[model samples]
Target: MAEKIFMKGCEAVAETAVRAGCRFFAGYPITPQNDVPEYFARRMPEVNGVFIQGESEVASSNMAYGAAAAGVRSMTSSSSCGISLKSEAISWMAGANLPVVIANFQRGGPGIGTIQPAQQDYLQATHASGNGGFRMLVLSPMNLQEAVDMTWQAFELADKYSKPVMLLMDGFTGTMMEPVELPEPLSEEEVAAIRASKTWAARGKHGGPQHKVMCGPGLDTRISQEQMNERDAELYESWKTTEVEYEDYMTGDAEIVLTAYGITGRIAKSAVKLLRAEGIRAGLIRPKKVYPFPDAAYEKLPLEKLRGIVSAEMSIPAQFAEDVERVVHGRTRIVTALSSGGEVLDRAAILDAARSLMK
Candidate 1:
């Protein structure tokens, strides 16, 4: 068995990315997520990897893009505002079908709202990560372990689909410390295999002149662009069939179901346990893959027995609830348990919402 290691969220995630064969990282300093790049700054050299604290988020994003464009495993990390700054480059990478992993330790928002944790970026991360009509595989982790595991998965998924993948974590999850068993590092042969498989990646004249490029409007370019879009559409559709992941807790016979993501989901889980002990038959649905939305989990619920659905989050407008509502489709009453302005969703608040749904 791999020995367990106790580490903070940012360090664990950064180290895990290294073990996953990521050889390049470029990021700007941002609250909560700063530790991620800080760790890489020191450790990346030991692994013969490159780490650059770009002049700004914009520069860091393009640095990552250049590295990945050259067939290297590359990544970047930042908070909400920093991510906003990187959006244009993110879209460019998507259009080029370049695989890169990004980590967003989200903070309260609109425009540099707060440094405290919040899920207000839910819509931005899922609905529109960039200007193009592109989709990213967005994974949200509720705990330190999940964050570490998903960071590793993010790289693999990005390579598999040849597109950018995001790990969406809030400030709390990105700063908390916990015990976790880190995976073994990938061998050089494995890393080489990953790079070798990408025949289309830029490799100078050694691979002969490459003609594949990102979006364009010329006659031949137009035809190829349409083909690429169609292929990307199919890739996105496959995630629904193969990658939608979520956790159902005490939901078998529950009278009310609480839906959330990230730390809010973790809190709702605690509320479910408390309500279960009181015979309220409360349950929780925590989506692991936020972009895919795990709507199928709701379909499997005992809707005939369900009384209500509670959407919990650290956002005032309840960014995560929009999709939950679309899935519930008025089969039951829907209420929100929200904590804004950098506050976390407490179990007591979730408990109160669950009880109110019972009423």
Candidate 2:
């Protein structure tokens, strides 16, 4: 049995990953997400695993790539700028179909943005996490508990799709302390089973056919291109069926829906409560997974009573709002309230936007 505790978001995610039988970790610490590695560094020794702090984000990502290629569950974490350095590595990992969980404790950006939570990276994670036409399942968690839960799921999705999975949770949502339930670490029996069942692992001493997991080999460029195309098509196809985490709060009879994710969704939820207190029929659509955005989430809303959709995000321009538009399909107007890092959108601003849409 796992113990329940109140913990920070990043810490919980780290513990969750370790408990799930992740044995390799390579990362550089940044604000908000720094605690993740700190916890792992202390906790991993108990399980006799490896925790390496690479010289740079580039080195850390490469280490993660190597670990995953060796067929062990591994991970890497970084903030916005750090994520930038890791783009190439992520692309390569996806091509090789190496499954490693990535945690991007997002914050403000464009350059080296502040250490404040922001959902602006939605484009970074959703549209093209890496370059090219490739795609990975980007799982977005809205709170501390969700952060932990989704980290485990990310590993599962990555291995299943033979691709990388990023757990997208922002700084505030990643750093804030919250209550959560945790499961006991994977047992030794489970670890032994994983090692023995080398269906796709590079177990160092193979006595069978050569197993080469590479997205691109210098010899056969065409094969690489074909694989990329196939994976891209599958990713898009999966997008329709991939929206696994989405919730509608007080939206049953709502005319206008507020769309947000991560901590911004929490803020929007508070705004919803206040709006309801004032007899405003407002609702919120909180998306847990941003990449494979939910399909037909607002199906029941009356088109006539529907005034408009409002997006509150910690980005300068609305990042999460665009996904809402993709989901809306011309059913309503789209309004966005923007903020970056420390500049959070006020509840009064959201309430006013909801009122304006009604009028």
| Clash-forming residue pairs, model 1 | none
After superposition on all CA atoms, what RMSD does each candidate show versus the true structure? 1.6, 2.1
lDDT of 1 by residue, 80-197 (tens): 9999999988988888888999999999987998999998899989989988688899999999899989999999899988899999998999888899989999998898888888
Q: Per-model C-alpha lDDT, please?
A: 0.88, 0.79
**Candidate 2: clashing residue pairs, number:** 0
lDDT tens digits by residue: candidate 2, 1-359: 45679998888898889888888898887887898788888988988888999999999988988887776778999888889899888888876777888889887888888877776688888878777656777877777778878888887777667678888888887778888888667796786566555466665546666655445433345466766677668776766675467878998887678888877887888888787777887899887777677756755566546888888888877777777777677878878877776666687778888888867
* Residue 148's lDDT in candidate 2: 78
TM-score: model 2 vs. ground truth: 0.93
Off by over 4 Å in 1: 207-223
Pairs in clash, predicted candidate 2? none
For TM-score, the strongest prediction is: 1
